[model samples]
Target: MTAPSPTPSIDTLERRFSDFATLGEALDFAATGKRGLNFHDMRGNLARSYPFSEMRSDALEMAYRLIAHGIQPTDRIALVAETGPDFAALFFGCIYAGAWPVPLPLPTSFGGKESYIDQLKVQLQSSDPKILFFPEELSEMAGEAAAQCSVEGIGWTSFADRIALKCELPVQHTDATCYLQYSSGSTRFPHGVAVTHKALLNNLSAHAHGMQLEATDRCVSWLPWYHDMGLVGCFLSVVANQVSTDYMKTEDFARRPLAWLDMISRADGSVISYSPTFGYDICARRISSQTHVSERFQLGHWRLAGNGADMIRPDVMQGFVDAFGEAGFNARAFLPSYGLAEATLAVSIMPPGEGIRVELVEESELTGMPGAPDRPKRYRAIVNCGKAVKDMTIEVRDENGAILPDRAIGKVWCTGPSLMEGYFRDPEATAACMKDGWLDTGDMGYLSDGYIYVVGRAKDMIIINGKNHWPQDIEWAVEQLPGFKSGDIAAFAITNGGEETPAVLVQCRTSDEDERTKLREQIRDKVRSVTGMNCVVELVPPRTLPRTSSGKLSRTKARNLYLSGEIQPYAVAA
Candidate 1:
């Protein structure tokens, strides 16, 4: 947090590489003599390999067909599909045509068709895309929604159809919009994040160089394609690096976590990957199953296991290491990295060989109470998110923008070439976030000895009786209690009118009267012991906690559900 030395000017870097004009050109150069993509559909036992030549050809053909279908250079197209060859074709197709491709989540409502239609209406109103592309299975429903919304120029097409289209012409582009990534739509309305060819290529160059990815590295992931980490981490990074990758559907992985490990082990994947907390808990749960032990899968070959997309949990990491250490997995291979869509994927990666490091501070000091001074406590485990990537700078700053010294908790702000140009079509929001080239990430954390430690989101910080508390800190405390699964707790602040109180919600393993009572007491006592704040605890069934597509808990959604009465509160013990 000390006033960081001045970051090198972007202008200086621009001058250094003035030769390359656009992303397509850079990609064309990078792809030379490199294999592009290897698609593995584990569910269907299908594998398809695309060399760079074929990929470029496919991209160009899709671009020609899109233009023939009346898509203009600046027109917007919305894509609703999972991670697969189709998604890649549509994304690169948009780039080729100089149109913007907006990736949307698969409709998540249990209300069936009507719910999907309503959600589509919201997105259509915000995006106003000229055309919509979806899976053939979803065409009828999407077409009906389009008609219902009175969206013009609607066409039903399959992924195969798009790929089959001939490459009759080539459309040249010097400057054009490539893709549009929508915000998570968690807090407020979602805005599109516009990424250009040049920006994307520059960011990819930085990422490939930072991660030290090689052409022979193979990637296997179950992250959703709609999210930035999924799209960029697994798909784009592999393609940009010209490596082979296998993708498993996220739901499929959730239903059978062991399959993820089986695939990685079978493939002998060099670059096995996932967000931090996901790999840890998934392995911890799966390895304990008798079925998982029968078919032994050695993870010794797995390198560059990444943990990102949410707050990296220390216990989760330790759980993974303890569970898999006997199976030949190295703790040092777990790379706790950081990035956002605005940064075009990865901003910084922890040094490759040094896994994760955790710090323990006196709980009272964190809550702003006058107690024992901070002491270095030995943690059986640590969760270090690594350091900032080369050429990027990170700072912890107070609310007023003044940088704080190391070990002082504050907002995490970053400045780098990979930062987004700005929020698409939202100048005011853009201006608020991007000041003097520094992106206010809204994440809370501190730096200690050149390592980054994320606490929680600034907006998610709970203030009760004049003490600051990170929801993660409380959640961590509750998770350690008996009968609580790791990562099963979510803490958020609930406010009505001008009064605010901290509420703790946990997913319980059992609904038995005695079990429920014990859980409630355990959660309350644990939180109070850690933060000195009395909390109201609610218990729900396992998997009832709200989660984003990528499996990270959504505090915002959980709070909304509580406020709307959709989530019922548990009875407090008298």
Candidate 2:
């Protein structure tokens, strides 16, 4: 057995910017080059170096195995995204076999086994995959979900052992669905987003163009593969753009996040990394406990630090710069982007060299809420979410679908070559969001000077007294208190005494009644400051508030559970 060394950042083969007819075509071209995907262990040591040639070869074999087992074109093949060679090979193998590959999430710490099974079962039922492939470790849980969904489940290792008859792969169409992506928020009624190879390739091309990829660029990621940002931006985009890359398992990143930084520090060339705000938040907090950041990390070469999949938090970005700037991390590397699965991967990306930029606007401008008479005006800093990617047009539309002028906060809509063909097998659901040629992003935002500033998700808005309030504003307010971290709070609207007021459920780890009471008071006062009105605040057990698979706080789920009595807040002593 030999230890693995990572692939080089630059290769001799000519670089092509994802101008391919299909993802398979993209992989075929990339395989001609020496660059490929690298997987790292928990301590940031390279465990496997999977060249694109090897990946394509393994995928061809896997495709043969699937075909020998009666897999057909357009068939949905679900595979648990494990951030390894096996899953990667199987995903591309499905594409080679003319089947639509579906990547599902591995279990998370917040959700227990049953919860995971339920989430998997819902997606399985929705996707109706011909077969579900997962790692051997998750067989117990995946098997149960497969059984419940009445779908066949097989471990990739066992499936790989099957005899694969040598045969030519099926011909693929660019318009045919290349894959099915379920949004991270897809919990109860999951809609499988169907994206064509044309759309996928187009988005990857635009993404590369947006970032202005150079031959010396390399990618580093620890995002979960189930999420669009990870699957498309980190995994597929790298191969399509013919860039070598490094990856740490999402769970490993969660446990030892600084290892992600450690890998980037050791990288010899330009490093391109992406994460949601929470990733930056976690790293910033973790580094505070460690001594001598300069001695550990060398981030001068990290070229693009992409931020997406959640609201961009300038404060968190600033905290990260505060912690690592001494170690050669430049604030200019922050590349904030806005996107969703329906748009393939990216809708808008901040141009390179532009660090975090924010604009302060009054509460009335943001939420349309009327301030108290003679009360001081309140304002919030909204982070600029960048501009639309190539071949994509963004417009803000009011509730009636009429386009709004710049800076008038409204529903954000986008139309582009990369937009998903539609939600797979759910036209009714698809029609609800698709307006003519534009995709109603279901996000509330405003456009100013050709840049977008996303306030938050529209559905997550809390309405009180005919004015709208963002739950994130309330949640962020509570997070300002000591001992609180990101994802520790969930806020939503609740009706009490026939009037709507914000209700917050905060995760309290303290068992002391006095401490819990104090925490509750602190949270209540904080929400009062943000909302300008006193609201209900409850302290629940730690991890009570649910998070989407992508690790964003799920206020909708929390509110439903609280209303249904599933989430019971602790009764603080008087």
| Model 2 C-alpha lDDT per residue in residues 1-574, reported as the tens digit of each score | 8887788898999999889999999999999989999999999999999999999999999999999999999889999999999999999999999998999988866446876898799899999998999999999999999989988999999998988788988998988899999876545557788999999999999999999998889999998888888999999999999999999998898799999999999887899999888788888888765578999999999999998876676778899999999999999999999988889999999999998999998876765556667889877788998999999999999998899998899999999999998998899988988977889988899999999999866787664422345677677778779888888988887757634578988888889888888887888877665455578988898878888899877777888789767899998685
Note the residue pairs that clash in candidate 2.
none
Best by lDDT: 2
Per-residue lDDT value at 484 in model 1? 72
Model 1 clash tally, residue pairs: 6
Model 1 alpha-carbon drift over 4 Å, by segment: 1-23, 26-34, 42-44, 109-111, 152-176, 185-188, 289-295, 364-382, 461-574
Indicate the residue-level lDDT of 279 in model 2: 85
Off by over 4 Å in 2: 461-573
TM-scores vs. true structure, each candidate: 0.73, 0.83
Candidate 1: residue 316 lDDT (0-100): 71
Worst window of 10 by summed lDDT in candidate 1: 6-15
